[model samples]
Target: MVNTRDLRVIAVLISLLFTAFFVLIILFRGEIDTAATATVESYGLVAIFLGVFLLELLPQYISPHLLVINAIFLGFHIVPIILVSILGHIFASLLGFHLGKVYGFRLVEKLYSDKTVSKISSGMDRYGRWIVLLSAFLPFPYIPVIFGSLDLTWKNFWIFGIIPRAISFALLGFGLSFLTF
Candidate 1:
């Protein structure tokens, strides 16, 4: 029978999966955009807030246009975008970590226990903090998902998580800002 820990893991998994799908929608412009831009500043702010919430609750970052939204609103400065993404992702990862530790690793192990993931998890643990940085810098599909799947330590997650993600985000912002240059 499923217990509270099982339920917690399930909830987190559901949130992550949902975020993945939402990221796809954002990537493909699948959502209706008719009233998106014309909407008031408050609407835009609300959207950003929601995006941040998703990042906190899920493992997808920069995938669902979170970085882009920040870049758009805060201007194309690499610093702000990087800072925001790093902080956002760090917090998200930490939240997941605490949940896993408090609830127990059994739930995470059960959910993410595919053959390939087994190998990935081992490698991730072996590499330790470095993995966080790499995951942060690398492109999507694997990074965030793996982090949540593995149920890493919050402290390690923040240290390794912040550097690469924040830097990559800065790079994106600067690149976009320089488009006219």
Candidate 2:
């Protein structure tokens, strides 16, 4: 069985790994965006699906919204972009939720600063399911792990989290179209 020391070690390692990822993202934002845009242009919706899936499944890489926006600027229809993104995001969120259920928040807690954790936990405690909705609608990370770790019901997660996420994407697609390229 893993002892407290072992768990702490694992948490530290995870923290380091995520920190490295965040640093890379900051350092290579332009290159990553160009490469991501090239991939979507080359592969089309398939690239968007995979990119969104992987980004959502893992933490601290990149936001899938960027990919969707890239697709928009690339002249792909908003409908397909929203549809593909929602599908990819929902699947990833479900898997992340299950991962939370299996693993709990101990390891995940290491991923964020203490203040961020407090915000997430407090928002969850005070607002309950609405936290999921807000997270979905806003630019907040769709961290199903936190929701699942907090023992949110699947129905609530779907209704408050998944659905609103889809709606937000739809809104983004439509709303962004109004802006000049």
Candidate 2 wrongly placed segments (more than 4 Å): 1-42, 60-62
TM-score for each candidate, following the candidate numbering = 0.56, 0.72
Which candidate achieves the best lDDT against the true structure? Answer: 2
Q: Which residue pairs collide in model 2, if any?
A: none
Please provide, for model 1 over 1-181, each residue's C-alpha lDDT reduced to its tens digit, 9 standing for 90 to 100: 3354666676678667766754654564423243344553335444443565465445332363443543353333345444555555556555656665665545555444444356557768798667667656665333444565566655666567755565565666666666522
Model 2: lDDT to the true structure: 0.75
* CA lDDT of every candidate: 0.53, 0.75
In the range 1-181, model 2's lDDT, one tens digit per residue, is 2354665676578657756755665566667667766665568888778878887776533467777766675567788888999899889999988887778778567554455557778899999889889888776767887778888999999999988888887888888887624
TM-score of 1: 0.56
